[model samples]
Each structure stands twice: as structure tokens, then as C-alpha cells.
Target: MTIATHIPLPQPLASLRRRAPGTVAGVDWALLSDSEARRLREFGLDEGVEVELLHAGRFGSGPVAARIGRMTVTFRRHIARAIHVQPV
Candidate 1:
């Protein structure tokens, strides 16, 4: 017989500043408005997608940028907070 183990590796994107890159786990839709959610979906921010933090706002008080696939997307800090990512 063979045994296998599963471990948890999910985290909020907002909490991953300056850390390792990760895959998009999920998004807290409840925390975002309809338009905001729609915009993010349009930008390809979905589960199983790869995302990396590129740059943060000045003193961490403005918008943030991240690399998603071949495109780079920028949004408010709050939006990043709503995104769940699993470190890669």
C-alpha cells in the first residue's frame, strides 16, 4: 500500500507582499462591487491562474501592480486583498 499526504498552501494576495510568487486560488467576491468583480474577471484574475507581485504603491498607500500571465495588471490595494493566492 502507498500513502499520500495533502497540505494546505493558500493565502490572501494582499498578505503576500515581497514574498514568493503564487497561483490565484480565489477571490472574495463579497468584498468587491459588481463592476470591480467584472473588471477583475475581464483581466483574467481567476482560480488556477499565475500571478506575481511586481510593485507596490509608494509607502504602500496607493495602487499595486502584478504580473498575470503575459499581461501586467494594476489595481487598488483593497482589490489585491480580496484575491486568494497559493504560493508556488
Candidate 2:
């Protein structure tokens, strides 16, 4: 789907700053895993889903929050670096 609102959040989260996760919670994040990347197209993390930034650490340290569908996945900042989301 599309992010219903516009938030001045950081990067990818700008569209998902204040949304809720749905069902595909464990889908990690596109910015995190390469091993899982190729398989992403087959999952719900596809284009129609909304991803939000729940929480982030200092300078990309610790774990960050990405709302993918119904789950808010806490991912490592390094993981997020690998993901690339275009403005929609």
C-alpha cells in the first residue's frame, strides 16, 4: 500500500513514521539481510506493505524499529544500511 501520512522521519521511515505493523512482523527488513533479499519479492514486504520507523539508536547503533506489516522489527543499524527504499 501507501503511507497514509507524510512524516519528516529519517529516510525510509518518513512515510511510515506513525503507522502500525500488521501481520508479517518477522519479515526482518529490506535494509538488513541480503540472504533474505532475493526472497523478499515473494513475501508481503513487497511494494504494497507499509514500513514504519518505531525507534532508532544513536548514530545507527543498537537496534532500530521498522514497522513491516503487523510487526515492528527491531533491526541493527548495520542491517538497515543494506536496504534501499525509494520514495513512493
Candidate 3:
């Protein structure tokens, strides 16, 4: 018999600054302010969406840019921390 074990690969986008791009797994809405959540939603950042981490500022603590769909969006590191992604 053969068995498979599924391991969770989702991680915060901010933590993936040095890693490869991934798909949007989920958002930690509870960690974000109402405005932040709304803004992210407006940017089309949701589960199942493909995302690519383009760049980050010093020490990966500054603004982060991610390419989603046909557009590229830049946001603060804290906001990126609230987004979870599954590496592709």
C-alpha cells in the first residue's frame, strides 16, 4: 500500500521576500485593520490568485511589490505579513 502525507506549505508573503513567488493561499484578516483589508481586497488579493514577489526594500522590512494577474501592486511590509501564500 502507498500512502501520502500532506504538509502545509502556506506562509506569510513578507517571509517569502527571499523565496520564490507563489499563489495566494489566504489572508490573515484578523491581523489587518478594516481599511487595510478593504484595500487588499480592492487590489484583487485573494485566495487562489497567483502572486509574484518582485522586490523588497532594505532588510525586507520596507515596501514590497508583488505582481498579480495583469498588474503589479506595492504595499508596506506589514501588509504583506498579513497575506499567506503557497509557493509554486
| Most accurate candidate by lDDT | 3
Against the reference, the lDDT scores of all candidates come to 0.83, 0.50, 0.85
Point out where model 3 deviates above 4 Å. 1-8, 17-19
**Residues 24-58 of candidate 3: C-alpha lDDT, one tens digit per residue:** 99999998999999999998889999888888788
Please list the Cα RMSD from the true structure of every candidate, rounded to 1 decimal place. Answer: 2.9, 7.8, 2.1
Per-residue error at 81 for model 3, in Å?
A: 0.6
lDDT of 1 by residue, 7-27 (tens): 556877766655368899899
Candidate 2 collision pairs: 1-48, 21-69, 21-70, 22-69, 22-70, 23-70, 31-83
Tell me how many clashing residue pairs each candidate has.
Answer: 0, 7, 0
Off by over 4 Å in 2: 1-43
* lDDT: worst 10-residue window of model 2: 18-27
lDDT of 2 at 63: 70
Whose lDDT is higher: candidate 1's or candidate 3's? 3
**What order do you get sorting by TM-score, best first?**
3, 1, 2
Q: What tens digits encode model 2's per-residue C-alpha lDDT throughout 1-88? A: 8879763322443223334432222333545556656545444565446566677766546776776666656655665544444433
